[model samples]
Target chain A: MSITRITVLSGGMGGARFLQGLLHGIAAGTVPGVSPGAEVTVVANTADDLWMHGLKICPDLDTVMYTLGDGIDLDRGWGRRDETWSVKAELAAYGVEPTWFGLGDRDIATHVVRTQMLDAGYPLSAVTEALCRRWQPGVRLLPMSDDRVETHVAIADEAAPSGRRVVHFQEYWVRLRAEVPAESVIVVGLDASSPAPGVLEAIAEADLVVLPPSNPVVSVGTILGVPGVREALRTTAAPVVGLSPVVGGSHVRGMAHQMLTSIGVEVSAAAVGLHYGDRATTSEGVLDAWLVDERDADQVDRVRGAGLACAAVPLMMSDVDATAAMAAAAVALVTDRGSVDGAR
Target chain B: MSITRITVLSGGMGGARFLQGLLHGIAAGTVPGVSPGAEVTVVANTADDLWMHGLKICPDLDTVMYTLGDGIDLDRGWGRRDETWSVKAELAAYGVEPTWFGLGDRDIATHVVRTQMLDAGYPLSAVTEALCRRWQPGVRLLPMSDDRVETHVAIADEAAPSGRRVVHFQEYWVRLRAEVPAESVIVVGLDASSPAPGVLEAIAEADLVVLPPSNPVVSVGTILGVPGVREALRTTAAPVVGLSPVVGGSHVRGMAHQMLTSIGVEVSAAAVGLHYGDRATTSEGVLDAWLVDERDADQVDRVRGAGLACAAVPLMMSDVDATAAMAAAAVALVTDRGSVDGAR
Candidate 1:
């Protein structure tokens, strides 16, 4: 079963890094079953999108584009390499709000172009395509949905009458540094959002689908929340597999632990795999196989008990080579299942 | 005849430099007949304004604000000092249009704030005020009008059926470098534009009105083209005086020569002075006195013969001190006239 078409659900940073390694593995013909010259399509989460300084900013989409195009600031893991923060500083000097977001000068150019196109009646998907022409990130990048779907987190605020205050996910993550306790995660407009053009089709037609180690709650979870996206993944003639964002009892990166906790899910590898669940047993599940880190190898039986083909591997994306090996392991684990009946 | 309140109709660069000197002279009490702490109000031309990259750019207003606030790039006489071109370079890399106009990163902040405010339904005057809070450009700065007034130049284009092509004033000046012969100058929406709030009152209540050495046809001319602006100057009791942008049969700086020629006015100090004419002699004129460059002293009589007091002085803004002396010379020339009968 040579996987000729691969689709990935992605967020920023970690997902971008994973995709870089995945593409590297495919180019080197090192992935277990992916065919040579196989195409990859990314359905990136847009719930992290925001409007600042009157410019539309899609963090996840830009991260993927810049990372794959070799423009990512390697140290920061996001934003353009050699980026200058003149606009951000100037905006701060003007005493404008949200001075915490480090909007780089080069990055603002992307936002400006996107905002102008959006203002001119181009949908988010079309704007992403237009912007990709400049990055040429090698794979087709599509927003999970063209419609606005912002993630809002409710945090404890004694000053509020309701004893809670809701802030945009960015304000929670970027501004507050996600240190405060989140009471709940509200994905505004998520349920109403239809998947962007070609999103469902990409998933249904793909030979295999891999979910990178992104923040499952806000990133991959938001993508699946889009109407018909989960159904497409369930009904597709493809092996559906996911790598655990959690290692041990905490997320490797990002605020996934806090988010997962806020949603009442245990911040553990076995728990996240079971949360995504086994498509064979439950109608709500979408994963046929799930891979956890070697450190969490002790929990493999717990996930396999839930009807998912489970495996443990070194999940750290320390370098391209290491991440590529992880991708190979994920593919080999799902392909070794020998049938797509569970994915169906 | 101590001038306590002064109003100046200004453009970019040259006008800003002149205002700097004028302020210096007023602050240092070097002017012949000006009271201490005299307030200046500038009615800057917005006809040369253009919207590029979906950002509203008022070059002349920004020039005045940045110059007076000491944030201007002194060498370039415009934009923020220590500016970075990251945004501009990134935009060009994205193949966005209007690459000719240099939108510096720090300068873009001003535009972003202004654009955001404008989109929020704030008028240009209010937006200008909001921006000025940061720059603290001492003098009160006001746009000629809140209404959109664009200056378009018709240049000889043989490829067109009409043998002429109309372009934005910025495109004509910056992109084309004004190399092509301009057939006509059109100030779109000028006739319909009412003076911005406080514009008419500033002119009417001023004790002295100075027209700086800016482009006569485009800058000052555009301000005069506003519906009630010229009438306010014509009916105001304040004595109106102007400095010749042209000197020694050519303009000292800027494309005043090309602009004058396009408007069928000779590019000579005396011709520009006479073109403004003596307010006493014609109901259409707006200058009671006009000053020419020392090099054009021979043409002073040509201007004096047009029923206006005329003088020749060192008009080059070589330094702040030299420019202050020129301002002093202008004030003295008007103050020596004694009677305000011609001005009225």
Candidate 2:
């Protein structure tokens, strides 16, 4: 039987770009040298969506939406191109409460509509689907949770003895530029939020699960925070393959290195794999395969030592062709092995 | 007795500009011979302030604020100059609701603060005061009422035989551009909305009352709709003078002609004086003094015929000098009569 469904666990820019390339590759039927009909499903992080200026902003979701809809500002890597700010400037003059985060004019329209629809009783999953209908992002996009789950960082400040205060992820990432080292990272409302509709179903039904090189902590970690999500990943019959976000010892973008250090994890593919260790240390089994950059070939044994099968590949998604090679490698890892438990 | 205070009945744009010139001329002690320390209180029309894009946009108030604060876009004559629209563009791409009217970025910041403060339990009058503190729009700006008194136009549509549907003034003004002739005009909530703080006091204790050449029907008329305001204008121990918005047979700005026609009043200075006709037509009494444009000099007796002392003067308000000259003329009209009614 031919491999059909593919589920991608993605974060923001890096993950979105990778998925764009992957979708392109898949559409061209050259991703993994496979035939057409590879249904792509992406579980996007929703922890970055925040209400600012009386607008409901879903940063990650919008990034994905705009990127896929051909509306993304290629230069900014976020928000729409040719956007206006007549509204925001006016709001500032009125002495609006929070003048911190910047919300573009075109971006505000999205939030207003999303907020209106959500307020009118549509579940987030349904709303995402409805929004996707307009963009036709090609691949099915799913928010990690139908309910609210915000990622917050604990930072040291003079106000607390621990010098710590919790800030929304965007406040830490965008506003503060992640200057203050975080003591801990917490995904708020995780305990109550359920996996978005079709999320687990997509994971369980996929022939292969691909973890794009997104920020491992906030993106993938936030996704797994949803109830039944980690459980599904562990028990799903499909083999899971993850690309390392860390090519060397630093993140491709953002302040992920500081985030990794804050969480007491070394910025390395080996450390990341170990964090999601195999059955020996995990209540649930680890990833069946982890793709590491050729530069880190010497560290593959560390991943193998953790009982995770490791492959050293030129995992650098330098271009569309290069990204397709990486995606094909991921599919090959699962297809060549048939199945994690030899079920195939 | 020294002339201690000045009360001005005003509308947006034209009224605001005229007020700015008057304020400048009075403050610099250059008004073709007028008293110094003449306190100016502007009774601003709140009829055009509508809730759009979740913002309480007061066109009249913002006009006065921007003009007086030296932030007004002289070219556009509304909103700030050098504004951005990154937020609005983003909002549009996201398919936000209510994308009809444009809101600028700088403009939006003002709304955001206003909305937040309003949500935080501050009344609009206090909010306007706080906002003015930043712009320092010089004169005390008082809304006609603290309540939600919106100007609605009865439009004829296929939905009704009378084609009569009451819409917010902004919707009629900005959205439709007043293409449809108004069947009737309704200032909703005015019946219950009491005059804002300082409104009655400002009119009751003024040395001279000047009605800026604003839209008589929507602006000044809306102010008159507020309870006790008309009475104060009639019985105040000061002269109430009005400079007509209409010159000859045309309004300087807006669809004032259509609005005037809705109330069955011809679009002329003489007609506007009759619309504010003395106690015979309005218990609030008519103009104690009326100033007509040189082009409408022939209509001075027509205004006088409406039971008010009238003066044919140059009321073009081309600049500070001209506006100050016109203001002096209005004061002279009242001063020459030497107390039309001693009871007032």
DockQ of each: 0.88, 0.47
Each candidate structure's count of clashing pairs:
0, 59
lDDT by residue for model 1 over B17-121, one digit each (tens)? 999999999999999789878999999999999999899999999999999999999988789999999999999999999799979999999999999999999
Model 2: share of native contacts present? 0.72
Docking class of 2: acceptable
Identify the runs in model 2 with alpha carbons over 4 angstroms from their true place: A33-35, A82-102, A119-123, A159-162, A279-281, A337-344, B32-35, B84-102, B158-162, B279-282, B337-344
| Model 2 Cα interface RMS deviation (Å) | 3.6
lDDT of 2 by residue, B197-250 (tens): 999999999988888888888898889878888888888878788887888788
Every model: iRMSD = 0.5, 3.6
Error of 1 at A328 (Å): 0.8
Off by over 4 Å in 1: A337-344, B337-344
lDDT string for model 2 (A217-299, tens) is 88887887788988888878877888888877677675898789977899998898777666445785547777777778778
Note the chain A TM-score of all models in turn: 0.97, 0.93
